[model samples]
Target: MRATLIPHVPETHVYPEAISVEFEREGGLLWLRFIIDDNPDFIAWPGDAPVGRADELWKHTCFEAFVTTDDGYREFNLSPSGQWASYRFDGYREGMRPADEVCVVEGLDGGRDYVALEGRIELPVEPRRLGLSAVIETVDGARTYWALAHPSDKPDFHHPDSFVLDLP
Candidate 1:
């Protein structure tokens, strides 16, 4: 399958990058790792705040990820009580439950559609490390990665006219 990076913002500021996923297993437990190159840094203003703001920020990033990828991917938040959150491509507001064992996400807007294949992944018997590459298929069947500018670099979410994705 081919992957394409669809910029969530405009073409002026964001740069597209490559994304990969690595999986590991130990004692029948599975561990998944996401490797994103040039991943934008999401900063929370004031450093700390009430739960409302925190939730808002999380939702904002989630939306950003959804739009940028056209709802083709999902993210897992590492923060406490915020684990395994899944985002879908059609729209996150549709209220899709996260996987019990894995967090799944898709783009908010209708991202390019591709068939997801099912297969078994093998890891090292003694905590072996496994890395699985994530392939994003564009509407035209091209593989690509999405990248965005850091909020601090632009400081204006109102005008996404500056964001861009560097496509491979």
Candidate 2:
């Protein structure tokens, strides 16, 4: 699959090998997991929003996590109370717009906190253009956009250098 650029941080630095993904199905749910190695010092504060340190970690790292079934798709959001908030996407159709969601996952002790972002994407019948974008902050206060371009059918998980973030 080929990845292209969408608007994002211009100076974003990504570790190609630091990305790992897995897909599995359990009972009536389809799961996709994405783990990326991110610096703990890099925090996300949503546009002057009031967020504590722990809350910031949850907001920045946790993108989205959910389950899908043949009947439709069910999405879950992580609550500050540490509970699962659920939602359903009954409007999902074969040729409709791609479904998008974001959530945060708490890290286990001794593990570096990270973000888990996912898209319950639907590919168009014909080749449809799509962009995968992410924003990360550096310890030095620089924000960069990491994005890739690929067809909806094939998600781009390769490093930015492979095609998405090609310098040229």
Candidate 3:
């Protein structure tokens, strides 16, 4: 499945022209892709820095996925710097724990005008819904939030209504 992520607020867009996330289920793994369309000189992406599983990647430029099943949900943060993290929430912002059970592989593709992140994770159950989002930080230290759907007036990815992508 593929969907375009729109900025939470139109007036707040500083750098990115477009952002999107796509997912493909293969065997027991889910391959995810995030694309950011922007001028290289304009966006402040963390170039080819080494990244590991860390917290608060969202403080900068990062790609995110909120996967929801029947029991709970998992939040995956994938950064261009090669760092990634996953958190399991029993409910909305409840029982937060490091989802270290899933191994993730992330990398960059393409160049200046457009860059893409390819990530793969072991998904044991089919997701019921997904909230795809991104936190884009510009060279001037401005941040913009993008998501598949912005149900609230503010940028709230955790809002239950943000899970607009219903799966089959």
Q: Pick by lDDT: which candidate is best? A: 3
Candidate 3 overall Cα lDDT vs. reference? Answer: 0.80
Query: What TM-scores do the predictions have?
Result: 0.27, 0.36, 0.89
Per-candidate clashes, comma-separated: 26, 11, 0
The TM-score between candidate 3 and the true structure equals 0.89
Ranking of predictions according to TM-score: 3, 2, 1
Q: Answer with 1 or 2, whichever has the higher TM-score.
A: 2
- Best candidate according to TM-score: 3
lDDT of each: 0.28, 0.34, 0.80
Error of 3 at 50 (Å): 4.7
lDDT of 2 by residue, 1-168 (tens): 222233232225453224333434333332344445554445442343222212322233233332334434433433222322334444332232224433333322223555443332222122112223344444455444334433333322222222322111
The better-scoring model by lDDT among 1 and 2 is: 2
Cα displacement (angstroms), candidate 2, residue 136, comes to 6.3
After superposition, candidate 1 runs with Cα above 4 Å error: 1-6, 15-19, 23-31, 39-82, 86-99, 102-168
Candidate rank order under lDDT: 3, 2, 1
Candidate 3 regions exceeding 4 Å error are 47-50, 124-126
Compose the digit string of candidate 1's lDDT tens values, residues 39-128: 233212123222221223233222222122343222223221232232332232343444222332221111232112122112112321
Candidate 1 steric clashes: 26
